[model samples]
Each structure stands twice: as C-alpha cells, then as structure tokens.
Target: MASSRSRRVEYDRFIPFRSAMDMDYARFALTMPSRPQRDGSRESPSSVAYQKLLDECILKNRSRILAFKSAPEAPASMLPQFDEPIRPQKKQQRRIPREPERVLDAHGMLDEDGLNLLDWGSNNVLAIGLDDTVCLWDDANKSSKVLLQAVEDSGPITSISWSPDSTVLAVALGNSVLALVDPATGQDVNVTEEDENQTPVLSLAWRSNSILTVGRSDGTVVDYDFRKDDTSICFYNGHRRGVCSLKWSALSGRYLASGGHDKLVHIWDACMPVSHHHPRRHQWLHRISSHTSIVKALDWCPTRSNLLASGGGRNDHCIKFWNTVNGACLKSIHAGSEVCALLWDKNKSELLTSHGSPKNQLTLWNYPSMTRAAELSGHSSRVHFLAGSPLGGVVASAAADETLRFWNIFETPKTTKPELPFAKFSVIR
Candidate 1:
C-alpha cells in the first residue's frame, strides 16, 4: 500500500491537461511578478531597480506568449469534415409513364371530331357519336371496321341508347326530336318528329319495343309509344327543374327513375298516365333529397333493380347507394375528389370511379364491402368520362388533357365465373 501523500503526487503527475496547450502555456508565461530585488542585496530593493527588471521580463516573453495564445483550434475545422462523411444527401426518385393496355383510335364514328356520348350494345359493340351521327364499333377486333353509321338531321346528338337486342339505336338530338335507326342497315325508322318549341332533349330511354321515354332540359318527362301512333301517353311535369338523367326499370315497365337539377330523384309510374291538359297525371313514387348539389348522373343496378346509386355535387365527394324499393341508403363511398364518372364492374360487386380536376385518377371499390381495391393516379388532369368493357377485362377513361387511358382490370386471375341475371349497380358522378 502507498501513503496518501505519495498517491496525491502520482495523481498530479499522471493527470491529463485540463485545457488547450495555448491557454495553459500563455497564462503561465504572461503572469506578472509582484516585485524584484537589487543584485546581491538582502534588503528591500529600490523602486528604479524593480521597474527595470519587470520591464525586461515583459519585453522578453511578450512575443512567445502571444504566439501561444493565437494558436488555431483543431475542432473548428474538423467538425464540418466529420459531418460530411456521416450524412450524405439521398437522390430523389423519378416517375415513369406506363403504356396503355388498349387503345380506341378509329375515327369518323363519333358525333363530331370528338366523342360526346358512348353506350355498349347487347352484342358487345360500342355505340357512340356526336350530334346526328351514330357509329357502332366491334370491341373484340381492333381492325373489325365500323359496323354501322346512321346519319340524322343536322343537330348535336345529346344522348344515345341501344335496344336490348342491339338491333335498334335511339338517338336524341338538339332538334328536340327522337329518331330510331336500324344499326344493321343504317336505316332511319323516323319514329317521331316534333316542333323546336320542345327544345333540348337531354336524356332518352327505351322502355319496351312499343314505348320510349324522353326527358327534356325544360323539366318534362314524356312517354311516347309507337303502339299509340305518335300519341303522348304520359307527360310528367312534376320535376321543378331541368331533368338531367333518366332510366327505365326492366323489373317494372311502369316505374321510371328520373334525376334533375332540382337535386331530387322522382320515380314515376306508367300505370297512371296523365295528359298535357291534366295538371296532375303523373304520380310521384319516392323522392330522394340526399344530394346537396345538382345530381349529375344515376343508375339502377342491372341485376338488383331495387338497388339504386347516385353521385356528383356532394360536399363529401362520395357516391351513395340506396334501396330503391324502400328509399334507404345502403352505403356511401368516400373519394379524394368529386367523382366525375361512375361505372359498375362486370361482377356487379365492384364500382369504378374517376376523379381529379383536369381528371386523371381512377379508383376501384368492392361494393357493400366498401373497401378500396386499387388506386390509379397516372393522369395529370380530371377524368371526364369512364366506360367499362362488356367482358369486364378493360376500362376506358377520357380526360380534358385531350387523351384517353385504357386500364386492364382483368390482369388479376379469377377463380370462378360470375353468376347472371347480374344485378350490378352503376353510378356517375
């Protein structure tokens, strides 16, 4: 064992320097002495001799002390160098454009240079065109050629509907008349011609072989039957505003669904037909007042006629599904932006919607399940329209960017065949 005094001495000798060498050495060398003694004298020194010795010490050591005090700090230069090696910046990732799954490039078929409306025929052909001209395309063969092109009076074609058998095409034009044409021969049937006073026929629906329903922007729904020979079987004046959408139910020929700018959906029955003279010929079935803005589009489930879906002009930017029989809302699907177009998948269990301003996004959802399956965000603008292929293998979307996008929804493997009399639902936002 060592003594305490010796241990203290060892600690002092071995201890590391507490400060930089410049600070410690400069402090020691620059300290001033209290007083100085005369040469070989044991008595108090004279003031003059003390002054002289003090001056000499300061002058001799001043340069050496300053050199030590001004020494450069190593840590200042080393910190930045150490940081550079430890944390390097990362490179940003870039997005690549994808190839379209299918393209519909054939021209001279749609109404004008651009397509205004499109509908699928019973035979899987696409019926589309601008005012007064209807063209049909065989979807299976890219080069199959235009199957039929029917030309009517010179006016903008607002809407088109194919007969259930795909044999007849009903067209509504700005001329305020409805024309039925044979798709196989491009022959005009000349069903009815009306005066220009009943202007802007916005929507048309074929109820049966004998009856057709026409909804006008002036808020009138007219039922014209060929069996009656040009007679207006029913005239609906209940819509307080412009009618935007119309549909005839396969389940009940008398039950017609109409949506309008009034943000109300009115169900009319054909069992009781009112004349233009009778102010109350139309009977209102159920009115849906859920939409806050003008209801842009609506569709009854083809398989489940009782299930109805509507979209557009909602504050939440969502699509609502309802039980048409009971007028009860079944489910609502939330989307990132206002849904511009809504379509039902071939399975009838899923819904496809397109959104985004300058509209470029496409999303798929499983119905009732209300879960999103996929999101397609490649387009830079709002998607204006969407159409699903009859075979359920593909979807086509149009945008204001002057481009069309084709999506392959059937890229995933399927396990079973879809059961029919399919009651799939469709909604357009």
Candidate 2:
C-alpha cells in the first residue's frame, strides 16, 4: 500500500504532462495493463482489481484533458505570437522642373520672327524682312533705321540674293517669277518675261555682271544675262532631281557646284557657255557621290577655294569636306544629328554645323583635321540656318523655335592665366 501510494504520488506529480517525455509515458501506461492474470482466462480479475485499474485509467485520461485545455491559455509572453500585424513605411518622390532657354546679346537685340538674312557687301550691315518689306541696318550706326524697303513682288518673296558687288538685290517670288531690285533706290527692274515651266527658284548665285544663275526645282540651272535684252540665257539640265543647293567658286568663276535630291554633287564648267539658239555645251567637271542623302547646304571656303563643305538630308548627320579638284573626301565630321545648315568661319579654318532633331546643337570643328573644337547649345528646336559675319565678330543662327540668336564669337575671353600676386611685385613688399 505504501508503494502504491508512492507510485500515485509520482503519477500525480506528472499529472499535467507539458513535455514530450511525460506524455510518452502516459500513452504507454494506457496501452499496456499494469498487472498480469494467473488464470488461463484471457479476461482480467473482477471486483476490486477491476475497480483499481479503472480508477488509474480515469485519472490519466482526466489529466490529459486538463493539460490540452490549459496549454492554449498559457501567457503569450512565454511564446512568440505569429498573428501580430505589421505596418509598412511610405516613400516620398521628388519632382524636378526643366529650365527655360535664354539668349545673350553683346551689341544689340532684334525682335523675333525675322527670316531671310543677308550680310551686305564689305559694309558692316545686314538685310532681313518678310513679304514685300525689307530692313537694312548698319552695325556701326546705333541710331540708324532701315536702310531700304521695297514692295517689288505681288506674292511673298521666297528667296533673296545680293549681287557680287552688293549693288543689286534679286528677289524670287513664290509665284515663280524673278525680280531684280536696287538696294539704294528700292526700285524693281522690269525684266519680267516669265519661263513657261516657271518652277520656283530654289537658289540664286551671281556669276558675273552679265550672268546670273538661278536653280529651280525642275533640276534646271538657268542663266539670265543682263548684257542681252532679247531672249533668256542658256539652261543647263543634267541633274535628274530637284536642286537643293548651288555654289559658285570665287577663285574659279567658271567652276559651278550644285547638289540635288539625286544625292550627287555635280561640278560643271560654266565658262563653256552655250548660246540660246545652239545646244548647251557645258561639260561635267566632276561628280561627287559622297553624300547618301539630299544635300541641303553647301559652302565654299573663301581661303581654300578647293575645299567645299556640304550637309543635309533625312537621317544624314555628317558634314563632308570634299576636294573639288580630285573629288576626294578630305575629312568628315559626325554631328550626331541631322545637319540642316553649315557655315565656314571667316578664317576658313573652322567649320560650324547646325544639327536638328533630338536636340539643337552647334558644333565647331578644325577644318582639315576634323577635330572637335567647341559645341554651342541653346536652341530648343531645329536650327535651319546659320550665317557668320565677314568681320568674324558675330554669328547669327535661325531655328524653327521662332527665335533668332546672335552669338558674339569675338567676345570669347582668352585663356591666359592671371599673373600671380608675388610675380607682379617689384623689389619692395
């Protein structure tokens, strides 16, 4: 009975089995009987023996029920709780605004929307205007007004050219007629017998006092001689496409270069003039098949007359310099965008090209070396035209963004470092 009491005390101590060892022992006792029977009968002894076994089984089962219920009610501090909610942090975004473009002027400022720019002969003057009105201003005279104005054409004038002497100004009208006006008198010459085919004159160049070359969209280069009064001069028709650019060399007056939509730069000897009554006798000097796109602009270097620069066309972003004598590409510069216009600096050693689309960028390059010199960025749209002053003081650029900007090239400060304070001192402190 003392042993039975000791066993009961041990069992009771482990009544609430919270650990795995206690629970395993409890399961083993429930599955196996505590005592074996001496009789041959499979059943256990009856009465007191059965009651003792029944009581032990009931106690063990009751303890298991109590432990399962109390296990869930234990303090949460003893174990980690997975049901806790978490909050996330919010992020902040910053916005940056774009900056507006600004223009700088060294001498004077002109109003916007002025197109068709021309630098007058030898004088520090410029002519610009729209429709029938033209304004000429002297850069030397601050108080001077428009030097000349004329209403010479009925339709809007599409093109303007100054004669070699800068005495006569020729205006090409939108209606496919040409008018010659005197800049000093603003009077139009009545030389108005229009060509029957009358295509819009795309470009104009003055070859001499007697001959004026006009390029049309019909791929015809016509010469109008002021010396003859009866019929028009000879028309040279070799370009199978519309003429986009024309240049007459100042060194060799007979050599004429024209670029067209056919992607070929045709060099013609204008000296072999054909009479209006006879067939054309002009000989093709050389053809440059360098540009793969339409040539929009061509400029002959004043210092190096044999070197010619041409640029423009869709997706063509290069400026090519060609030697007219041999028809070889001397050098090419990648402008990284479609080159719309090109101008040689007054010194003829540096070339400036204006690119369009993606960005309006102006790039200057050392001519024969093709090395990048500088890049000017300010325009917001496609730069369509660039004109450099003969005096090398200023450069004027026009863009589709409805603004004209004048860059003062002469105002660039020299890169000499300032003298040190000690170096400038005399013998005394």
Candidate 3:
C-alpha cells in the first residue's frame, strides 16, 4: 500500500513536467506526442517513440530558421553606414589666348633651313631675307623696298641684324662676306673682302653700333670695328663646327652668347682684358653642353641680366635656361618636338617656343614657372624663325610652309572701342 502511494506522487510530478514541454513544442510548430498504452497492450512502444522523434525534428528545424533571420554579421557591407560622398576636382586656369592676329602670304619669303630670315628693327622696319635678296618693310609708312641682292656668284643672304641706332643694317652673305647697308637708300655702304677659306658666314650680331661679330662654318668668331673698315679686331675659337646662332645682350653690354652646330653654347665677356695679342682670347665665361644637338635657338632674358635661354634641334628636343654669371643651369623644359626658335616678351614674364616635326606648333610658356599657357596652331610645317616687334606686344613667325603669321599674344585687355583691326598691316608689294 505504501509503495502504491509513492508511485502516485512520482506520476503526478512527471505529468505536470510533460505538459509544460508539450506547450513549448507547440509554440515552435512541432507536433505533440499521442497517448501511449501503460501495459503495452493497445499499441507497440516503437510507434510511440517514432511520434516523439518527429516532434523533435520539427522543433529543431524551426529553431534553426529563427536563428538565421536574427544573425548580426551577415551582409554587413551592404549597410547604409558604409556609404560615402564624392567631391569634384578643380582644373588649372589657362593664361594665354591661342588665336593669331594676322596671317600674311609669305609665298617667296621662306628660307630652306633655320636661318634667321626675320628681324624687327627698333626703327619700326622689318627686314627679311628672301633667297638672294634682302627686303625692307617700313611698318610706319607701309612701304616695301628691296634693300640689296647677292652677286651672281655669291650664295643667298644668310642673316641680317640692324644697328642699335637703326640707321644701318649688317647683312651676311653666303659667299663669306659681310656688307653694311643704309636702310634709306637701299644700297651697300661698305663690303668686306671675301673670307680666305670662303667659309659661309651663317650668323652675325652687333655688340654695339660700331662693333660687329660674324660667325663662320669653321666655328671661328671674328669681331670687326665698323670705324676701322671691316678689319677684325679679335678672334674667338670655342666651337667645333659651324656657328649658327649669336646674340649680344644690350642690357648686360659685356656678355655675348654663341651657339654652334657641334652642340655647344659659349658665353664670352667682351670686357675681359687680353694678356697677349696672338689670336688672344676674350674670356669665355661659360661653355654650356646642355644641348645635345645643334643649338640654333638662343635668347637672353630682357629683364634678368644674367639669364640666358637656349633650345636644341630635333633629337635633343629640350629648352634650357642658364645663369650666365655663374654658369648654373636654372631650368629645363622637355619640349616634345624640336625647338626651332625662342622669343621672350619684354613687357611680360612670358616665353614662346616654335617647334618642328611632330606638332609643328608654337607654345607660349610662363617664365620661371615654366607652365604651358597656350598652344598656337595653323602652320602645316616647322616654324623655324621668330621675331618680336618693338611695338610692345606683336610677334611674328616664319615657317617652312612659306607663310608668315603674327600674333598679339601679350596684348593687355582693354575696354571695347571702335578701333582699327589689330591684324590690319599693309603688305608692301
């Protein structure tokens, strides 16, 4: 009797626990177990066990799906917190205008190579060498006249330079002779005897109104005193090949720069005293070898007394600026194409370069900064020669295409008014 009473207590406790478990299974979408036979008479125990297994499987699958939906780590990168805003970049400002002011039909004016065929005289006259003839164009009066012509046996006129006073012009002929001509009368006032070797006189520069320097093919430079009747006062020998370009700085007065086909640029000091008079030397302050090819393009900065700029030929394709006082290379620019000529604006800190081959175009660069300001295009061939006008802002270019184009690139802006066309310049026939 006591045993039966204990069993009844145990049954009561287990029944309540089983009922709580069934409620939990129902909430989880699981099937509840059916009633089982106490004495194994109504049904087999295996069937009761199978029913219990099915309820557990349903409960486990439901729990797994609930856990998956509440996961915190999945797809974290797709959240709104990962988004960012983008900003735009600013562009560089252009400094120069690209259009040209005038285009002239220089049908017969172009030379075959990189001879300085164009020069602007301080007296407002333009001198151009066309083959065997040297012509003068008066900008003030709009009149053109043939200044002089080469002799039948002489080669074409190679270079021209006007005196500082602008009263006379020094012309270099192909037969290795130099002539002084009067602009007003269009006649040679005096001519030098033929060179002993007959080496072509490719370049000439005036150190002053009375002193002139001529460069020859054998790389010898001779200084002549106009007051002494074409007699050479001194000789400078530093270049290995033809001396093709020469520039004398009026600002510095004593510095003279010469460039040669052997890829050398030398700066000479005319103020240096000679120790003896036997092919005696004028001091060569610097021997610049920065240019790898013929150094045809040379110019001195008008504002900076010691600064000099030079450019190389097709293979070199570089422009270098130098400090003539110390012979230090201050700046270098990789002009993609051949640099044929260089011009510096007197009124602004701007420099212009005329190029050949690939992009036969003109590039305007800001000084010191060396930034490209503008690119002027129109010429179909290499632009070899360049000259800047004394009229403040005008520059002219002569190209291999036999055309002369003028650009007022450095002109300052002004209020609009009824003014004559800037491009209107009379072509003297």
TM-score of each: 0.63, 0.63, 0.72
lDDT of 3 by residue, 294-354 (tens): 8999999989899999999978999999989899999998999989999988867889999
After TM-score superposition, the amount by which residue 180's alpha carbon in candidate 2 deviates from its true location, in angstroms, is: 1.3
Candidate 2: clashing pairs of residues: none
Expressed as tens digits, the lDDT of each residue in 1-429 for candidate 1 is 766765432234566556524675556556845222335455455765675576677644243435655646475756555445566678763222244565554333231211235677667877665334555667777533343343455466677777777777878776676778787777677656668677667667788766677778778888777666646876776787777777777656657888777878777666654566785468677788877666655666667768777776545376888776677889876665666666776555777787765335787777778787777776666665666666665776655554555787533326787765534646434
Candidate 3 error regions (>4 Å) = 1-97, 109-114, 277-280, 412-429
- Tell me the tens digit of each residue's lDDT in model 2 across 1-429: 255544432344646546426676667777876532334465556765775676587645343444555455468798887888886777653221122132422221222111233434445555554444455655566333443343455445455667777777777755677777776777776455566668777677788855788877777887787767743666666777777677788877867888877787888776665656656546467887778787766888878878788885556777888887788888776667877777776654777787777878777777678886667777877776676655664676767665656666422323578888778677764
Candidate 3 minimal-lDDT segment of 10 residues: 29-38
**TM-score of candidate 2 on Cα atoms, chains taken together:** 0.63
Cα lDDT, all candidates: 0.65, 0.65, 0.82
Candidate 3 at residue 73, lDDT? Answer: 52
Steric clashes per prediction: 15, 0, 0
